[model samples]
Target: MSRRRSARPAPRPLRPAAERIVDKRDGQWFVRPITGATSVKTYTCPGCHAPITPATPHMVVWPVEKALLSADAIDERRHWHSACWTRRH
Candidate 1:
């Protein structure tokens, strides 16, 4: 018998900016968008001027928020933009 794969819509990508309004050992309590309305702390990428987004579960986030952290926190200091990181083949 042959099996067929179902076509599910690709998930919405993460937001360009998000903040850890709440931090815990488990994870962020609440992370909202980084917009001009609020004083969202952000770092500009040296390479692309595009805002950097966080690396998060592709599933947990639908129209997700970018995770920002101290440069020392992540394995690589290189921050990623939602579009840049979520680039599909």
Candidate 2:
């Protein structure tokens, strides 16, 4: 009698490192880079107070804290131009 062998499972794909944590004097910030291909809407940059048009590559920043809830963090998030975010003091 011939025995049947089970098939091996497919390996999981590795996830990209898309988000980073930045420590500033004010607080710990979670920054995510938005690629032009994925940016779909316009946003006002808090750093320069200018409009970030659709398809523009930018950074999205939000403060992180033990006491801060997920909803609050989302509400506090801001979109900034890459240059402006880098230059923010």
Candidate 3:
């Protein structure tokens, strides 16, 4: 028997996720069509210049109890696997 790959349609990437700005104060994410200091910028990977997509840089600020904490727990940049992120490095 031959194995068949799952045939699911590609999901539409979130517009804001594709282009976003995050409010660290409230852990809220704002989608922006333009690029700014706060907006997450997509760049070419240093190793291969392959385009890299990083989810908007956001801080976890929710549930009240978790407020006032440092910005260290958010895994905001995992869109690209390590191999791709550091391919050139």
Candidate 4:
């Protein structure tokens, strides 16, 4: 007896590139767009020395060149308020 195979749809392709931001003074930072569906985490802003509350929408930044490993660098990344980050200069 011949068995029939069930057809499955192809998986969606991953994003080609991630959005990144580069600040001459601040080095580089990766941009992460957070949808409302995901839980938001709070962080302290290094620029203004203020807290970045959850669900507020902000930026995550890390040094462009560091001696630490990538994982460690990411771990050292800082969260900042969008406006504050823009006026960081």
**Which candidate tops TM-score?**
2
- Index of the highest-lDDT prediction: 2
Report lDDT per candidate: 0.39, 0.85, 0.40, 0.67
Off by over 4 Å in 3: 1-39, 56-81, 85-89
- Residue-level lDDT of model 2, residues 12-73, one tens digit each, is 78564389899888889899999888789999998889999999999998887634456577
Q: What's the C-alpha lDDT at position 23 in model 3?
A: 49
Q: Assess candidate 3 and give its lDDT.
A: 0.40
Tens digits of per-residue lDDT for model 4, 37-78: 342776788889988777776766666565455656567767
TM-score, structure 3 vs. true:
0.22
Model 2 CA lDDT for position 58: 93
> Which 10 successive residues of model 2 have the least lDDT summed?
65-74
lDDT tens per residue, model 1, 1-89: 99978699779885566543444344433333333343334555434566543433211112123346533333233433434433422
What is candidate 3's CA lDDT for residue 11? 92
Better of 1 and 4 by lDDT: 4
**Residue 16 of model 2: what lDDT?**
45
Q: Which residue pairs in candidate 4 have backbone atoms (N, alpha carbon, C) closer than 3 angstroms, thus clashing?
A: none
Candidate 1 displacement at residue 82 in angstroms: 0.7
Error of 4 at 26 (Å): 4.7
Misplaced by over 4 Å in model 1 are 1-39, 52-75
